[model samples]
Target: MRATVDFAPLFRSSVGFDRMLNALDLASRIPTVDNWPPYDIVKTGEDDYRIDMAVAGLAENDLTITQERNTLVVTGRKAQEPQSAAEYLHRGIAGREFERRFDLAEHMKVTDAHFENGLLSITLKREIPEAMKPRRIAITSSTTRAEEAVPQIEARKEAA
Candidate 1:
């Protein structure tokens, strides 16, 4: 009951975007993927972004955030507790271990992270390198004729 999406047309026009397109294709195929511990991605500014995840029972020590070359991983591991006489009659909040991954674009860097009121906020900024930025080329027009622009080569004389 799933409809497949064709990305052949996009592949012809885009370069270096195969990974992103493939990821989208895979995501479409797997519709029942784990969605525990809901999270939201928000764009605050033109080059600034934030990911806020609601982890009700997890503490700062229970979670780990890692930023690799082009991926961000968020993992939560709940500490095992000793057996208590009090048993949960109706358990609602999720306290299980979970790992979530996010694909990041090039030049994206993680700047800060904050844990407040059962929510983890991760801030990211896009910083393009100086070499990668576009620059204007200088075009100079001189009054000199085309003859002066060419360099003349002199013939070498044979020595006795």
Candidate 2:
């Protein structure tokens, strides 16, 4: 079975895009014909994430990774053959040019990236500001005593 996501609603709706959505749309459309490289997105910690992309038969020089605003773009092109000497019997694996993009959340930054064993690993960390962090309020006696206090009523005299 294959998974399919309908983006017609997304196209119809008026959603505010800030650089990220554009890249995401392009990435989703790129895998329409073929999903060549399998990838994985993992949450490592509270604010840390990892994106692993399988890129076999690709060299560091042939691949390029770039980030603009909150979008990460990856492109790769296999080197052309020097000469078509012998005829090929069977060709199963696909080696072609590809471009992929990913939309990143706000405050998320790519800290480290490494490529090993045909896998490109990218680490992301979201750093929250001090003001944005969860704060604990100290319970004091003043607040508690205010709630316990009773209301006082003044007696009124009837006028002739």
Candidate 3:
């Protein structure tokens, strides 16, 4: 049994939340085709995350990782080559090209990426700007001395 969410009602009233709604919709429909090249996402620290992908048999030149705004795009394209003369009785490895996209939250930055032991690891860290971070404001008591206000001088009347 599966439950369906209808955003029609919310769409009529909510404003400036289309992106979030779209993400929710996308997440709800996660069972899509082409799930090749498995991947994993792990939270290593409070503000750190890592995405590891099992990209076996793929060379560094055949993969592309790009960060565009709040979206991360990972594409794998095998290099074109002449067909091997050797005949294979069975083929198990997947050589088809694929593209995967991941949506990241605000302030998320890709710190490092490395390929080792047939696994591609991508590290991410959230860097909040000072202006956007929460700050504490000092409170002053009413009895505290205040600076004197500058008095405004009256303008002289000109003779008509």
TM-score (C-alpha) between model 2 and the true structure: 0.61
Candidate 2 per-residue lDDT, tens place, 1-160, comes to: 4454565576667566535455556566665665767789999999999999899878767788888988888888987777878887997556578988777887788899899988889899998789988999977797787888588897897998
The best candidate by TM-score is 1
Query: Which residue pairs come into collision in candidate 1?
Result: none
Note each model's CA RMSD in angstroms.
Answer: 3.5, 9.3, 4.1
List model 1 lDDT by residue over 17-66, tens digit each.
Answer: 99989988888888867998899999999999999999998888999999
Better structure of 1 and 2 per lDDT: 1
User: What is the C-alpha local distance difference test score of each model?
Assistant: 0.91, 0.80, 0.88
Tens digits of per-residue lDDT for model 3, 1-160: 5567888788789998898888887777676677878999999999999999998878778899999999999999989967989998997877668898989998999999999877889999999999999999987765553554558899999999
**True-structure RMSD for candidate 3:** 4.1
Those runs of model 1 whose alpha carbons end farther than 4 Å from true positions after fitting are: 142-160
Better of 2 and 3 by TM-score: 3
After superposition, candidate 2 runs with Cα above 4 Å error: 1-34, 84-86, 136-160
- Considering lDDT, which of the candidate structures 1 and 3 is the better prediction for this target? 1
* Clash tally, candidates in order: 0, 0, 0
